[model samples]
Target chain A: MKIRVLVSLKPGVLDPQGRAVHHALEGLGFKGVDDVRIGRTVELDVADETSDEALTEMCEKLLANTVIENYKIEKLG
Target chain B: MAFRSAVITFPGSNCDRDMAVALEQVSGTAPLRVWHGDAELPEGLDFIALPGGFSYGDYLRSGAMAANSPIMREVIRAADRGVPVLGVCNGFQVLTEARLLPGALMRNASQHFICRTVGLKVENAQSLFTQGYDAGQKIQIPVAHHDGNYFADEETLDRLEGDGRVAFRYTENCNGSRRDIAGVLNKSGNVLGMMPHPERAVDAAHGGTDGIALFEGAMKALASA
Candidate 1:
């Protein structure tokens, strides 16, 4: 089974990298860009029987820092 | 008995020797250098230090990979037993990742790696690490890091301030850490994670000896116990 995990800073958390890119985009004359937030995507291949609880555990334990980030797991064929 | 200390060295740890030297200078005995792969730490350790560096090359997240190393299991156990642990810079990130400390270190607000000596205010003079400094005393320490901006939810931040868990605050907000918190102590005050490098400031020849008090304070606490 193929799994995709998207990790992102929680709402209201300040993301300096995302803000810098936002500034650069504006400097290049791009308009109407209200905000930009950067995140990470992790892909994994696991046994088809991998349980949802196990995957959630992985996120809580290592894939994402629950203190400042949130993670979503997507099951793709 | 000479104070026993140990410094854990990860694959990319650059300040392990400096930390060992600082420990030796203060404790009067060389600290044991332990490898990250070692599952068990030597018994009878009075103090443990996780020095700063790009551990695991700062992959995934700063200190993320190193937090999960084999030796962390032992570190965590020792911390639970009330052993004092100090984590500086990248080591601070590892402690947060290991859930030994609260908050996460993000990129600097200016998006630039900052490296310079900055002023810090000692917030909690009762902690083993900060007891050497007078409460509210301002001291100069060097901070060098890209992702040293500390972040935690508002409630957690409030609790930290209310409970006197904050050990040090930057005199000037250099990294955008909430409440200018440059360092924090765990609930029991046994573990401390800080962005500034006290070990680097221990010697007057290194620019200042403001950091000597921290090591001396720890030794005094251990000796009296």
Candidate 2:
């Protein structure tokens, strides 16, 4: 099974990179852009018997830092 | 008695030698060098230091990979047993990633890597690490990092303050850290994680000796205990 994990900074956490990107967009004359928040995607190929709990554990243990980021696990089939 | 300390070095760690030298200079004994792949620590260690550097190439996140290294498991256990552990700069990030300390170090508010000497106010002088300085004393330490802006929830910040666990606060708010925190201690006060490089400021020829007191204080406290 293939899994995709989306890790993003939690709301209310200041993301400097995202803000820089937002500023660059404005500088390039792009209008109507309210904000930009950056995140990471991690893809994993695992055995077919991998359980949802295991995936969650991986995110909790290492894939994502739960202190300032949240993660979503999606099955890639 | 000689000070028995160890400095853990991850593959990308660059300040391990400096940390060891600082330990040796203050304690008159060289610290053992431990590697990231090591699963156990030497027995009867008086102190443990995690030095500044781009550990694991700052992969995934600063200090994230090293926090999960084999050696950190033992470091965590030693901390639980009340052994003093000091993490400086990248080491501070690792401490938070390891859950040995609270909060996360985010990118600087300026979005630039800051490398300079900054003023720090000794917030809690009672800690084993900061007992050398007087409360509210201003000291100079070097800070070099891209992600040193400290972040913790308001409630946690309040608790840390209420408990006197905040060890140091930046005088100038250079990184936009919440509450201007530059260093913090764990609940037990045995572990300290700080973004400033105290080891770097220990030598007179290095432009300052303000950091020597920190090591001296720890050694004094541990020796008398």
Identify the CAPRI category of the predicted complex in candidate 2.
Answer: high
Stretches of model 2 off by over 4 angstroms after superposition:
none
Worst 10 contiguous positions by lDDT, candidate 1 chain B: B124-133
Provide the global lDDT of candidate 1 against the true structure. 0.94
Residue A16 of model 1, lDDT score: 90
Interface RMSD of each: 0.7, 0.5
Q: State the lDDT of candidate 2 residue by residue for A1-77, as single tens digits.
A: 99999999999999999999999999999999998999999999999999999999999999999999999999999
Candidate 2 lDDT tens digits, B1-225: 889999999998999999999999988899999999998999999999999999989999999999999999999999999999999999999999999999999999999999999999999999999999999999999999999999999999999999999999999999989999999999999999999998998899989999999999999999998
Per-residue lDDT over B1-225 for candidate 1, one digit per residue giving the tens place of the 0 to 100 score? 978899999999999999999999988899999999998999999999999999999999999999999999999999999999999999899999999999999999999899999999999999888888899999999999999999999999999999999999999999899989999999999999999999999888999988889999988988998
Tell me how far the alpha carbon of residue B163 in candidate 1 is from the true structure, in angstroms, after superposition. Answer: 1.1
TM-score computed on alpha carbons, candidate 1: 0.99
Candidate 1: where is the Cα deviation over 4 Å? Answer: none
